[model samples]
Target: MSLIAWAIGLALLLIFIFALLSPFEALGWWAGWGKRGLEPSPPSDEEMAEAQETVAPYYIVYLTAIGGVSAEDISKRERVFLARLKEALPDAMIVTDVFPFSVTNNPLNGERLLGWLWRRIHQSRMKRSLKGTLFGSLIFLRNLLQVAVSADPRYGPINNVGVANEIAKSLVRHGYPLGSGAPIVVMGWSGGGQIAVGVARYLNQGLNAPVYVVSIGGVLTDDPAVAYVRRLLHIQGSKDKFPSIGDILYPGRWRIVPHSAWNRALAAGKIITVDPGPMIHTGRGDYFDYRATLANGQTHVERIVELIADFIRPIQDVAQPA
Candidate 1:
């Protein structure tokens, strides 16, 4: 090969290697990506019959957190409010124990030199100093080279929207196939909020039924996807950090307040905002306390449950002649 051709080939090879080593491919999974393996078996036949008969016109969806916490971790704290919800709406079909989606982990292949070169080209940027710049760049390049040899195909592109659609379809197939006639309320915390927003947006196109979505400490953003959930009731607490208001990339690097700004926008709307009191701030852990009511005359947890009920309440109430 000509010297020029060799250099061009080498540069391309390096870019490809870097792409392979880039940990950004792991973006799809995030913290809560593969938390749940698969959908649990549906309630028994008798339970289904009972659910159909007793469950109200509303569907209750509980979205799990993506911080690697188990569903049990969620239920332990939120059970008080969930139990109250169950009691208030006896026939309501409540579905918890479902995860966001399955993430196929695709590690880089480390067999070929060209592959290694490809991986090095795709890594994060670095500085200009000997230690801070060159050293870091070389380390990143080396890591990319290692990963390029054995790349996994599964991590190519994640269909988060598709996962949300599947969850919606499951709700229809198992519970109310006819949605407009019934109401559906979805509540998710953290990353679960992202998936819940996707499900409601996709389903809302077909079924105009009142779809109420309440996200606690959810990672809400101003992206096109989140715009659909704008009409859905969204609640954000004041203190919880982590996934606070939009993409929080590089902690302490440059704080971008997308989620916080979104909350500000909602505050100007007709949606009811509930403060979950000061317990541990973020909606993570067992902070779903129903008793902590803010001065706004509403308890964060209880108000959430009540919102679900009120949202599903028939539209003919006030219209009825007194």
Candidate 2:
């Protein structure tokens, strides 16, 4: 074989090896071997009491991209998007924590082993070092594997529950009305889309509340969580093609498979798809780029934030306190 062919083959082999080893972290967490985050816990008495009182109009838990290292480690565009979203929905509680890739919600640079390496990679990324992108791929691939675990029937149940616990804890921590039948909208970007949908079933029952999922170019599997989600809005851009990877990888997402959960949700009108003009998955002209201007004269992030805010806005008065 040619030298280039040999190199390509080696790369594929390494990726396969990485995939094979990806589930160990989550497995260790479940087996009580990892020390980053605790197992799922029920709501406290105080949290239950807080659930009864009046709360924010609605909740929005924003899940970051797979490139994310920690809850707080987000891109400048993402931070700007969250800030803009908060301004757009001042009455709604917007949550930016809850590392979507970790079943225990443990960040890459958290208490887990090999954290020092991840910390350095995160720092390098902040400095915009080329080496950061090189090292960040490892984190990206790690989270990507977790996404696959969430979609795999063999591991999804155990994994999804752990992630759901994290989301539940975040909501309760932020004073979400648990038993109040209030609504939560999970705005998941990229890989987070799958996670946002994956945890819907548990979140729905855990808090006795409704859950909505808004996927911004999310890679989703045909998990049963789709059935439990109150509503799912899949917003994609015409120029983006990465989202199609999910469709290609998961047979259940294929149109020919009429019986899959994703298809069923589509048939029942539980899933809504929107294409907000031209954009790509990431980088220069990606959806959240602050400098990427659309034909309508709106920045990429502005248009998307508006769409998200309008979709989840409530009818009742959602004004701020005096």
Candidate 3:
């Protein structure tokens, strides 16, 4: 075989192996792997502004997109978008340090053995190389598997609760008073959506708080946790077909499945679907792209922040979890 063919075959083999092992970290974490350092490292000075706790009407714990290297190493567009979100909702406390991709909250880009590989591929992606786009997809694929695990009936309970506890700890670190029953809104971007829904019940149970979810271009599973969610706001762009895949592949998301968590939420009016209009899942024209301007002169991020900020502001509910 030619060198190109050998390379292609090797890549295919690696991907197969990667997929097989994708669930290892989550499963291991639940099985007590890496239990010692579950708490995330202390934030740097740059992150302290959003890391500290404060008395606010709402506590927003953000889950970065699957492409994240770490909670702190999100995309420039995401960084700008999040900063803009904090500015838009000064009354809300935003905790951006929770890395939901790992049940133990360990970043893929941190001190792990594969951290260097992730960094190299991530940098290639930053340079917009074809090689980067191809290899960087491994990050997306791995995180997507974690989302599936969170939706899987067999593992969802154990893993989601573990992740929820990790998130609760992060919230406490950020100054959240556990058992305060302060409303907790999880803002999930991209693959973060299913994760947000997957962990809602546990977050509510752990913190005794009213748990809400706000998903932007998130591919959500019809996880049973949706049944316990206080409310959900799914923000999808009109042109983004990525989210539709969740419905296409997950039978629970189908209409005929009347008792599915998704349908139940809809029947009970607990889910709100909003079309931000003319947005893609990611990249140049996606929701967080500050360069994409509408005829009204607002960037796509600005427009989305305006919509989400409005819904979040008047939420002063003090309901505790059952």
lDDT of each: 0.48, 0.83, 0.82
Q: Name the runs in model 2 displaced over 4 angstroms.
A: 1-13, 36-40, 44-54, 314-322
lDDT of 1 by residue, 41-137 (tens): 3323554454333323556677665432224434445677788778766766777645443222121222333435323432322233454543334
Query: What are the root-mean-square deviations of the candidates from the true structure over C-alphas?
Result: 13.3, 3.2, 4.2
Rank the models by TM-score, top first. 2, 3, 1
Tens digit of per-residue lDDT, candidate 3, span 247-285 = 998999999999998998999999999988799998899
Pick by TM-score: 1 or 2, better one: 2
Q: lDDT winner among the candidates? A: 2
CA lDDT of 172 in candidate 3?
Answer: 67
Residue 102 displacement (Å), model 2: 0.7
Say which candidate scores most in TM-score: 2
Better of 1 and 3 by lDDT: 3
Winner on lDDT (1 vs 2)? 2
The weakest ten consecutive residues by lDDT in model 1 span 144-153
TM-score of each: 0.52, 0.90, 0.89
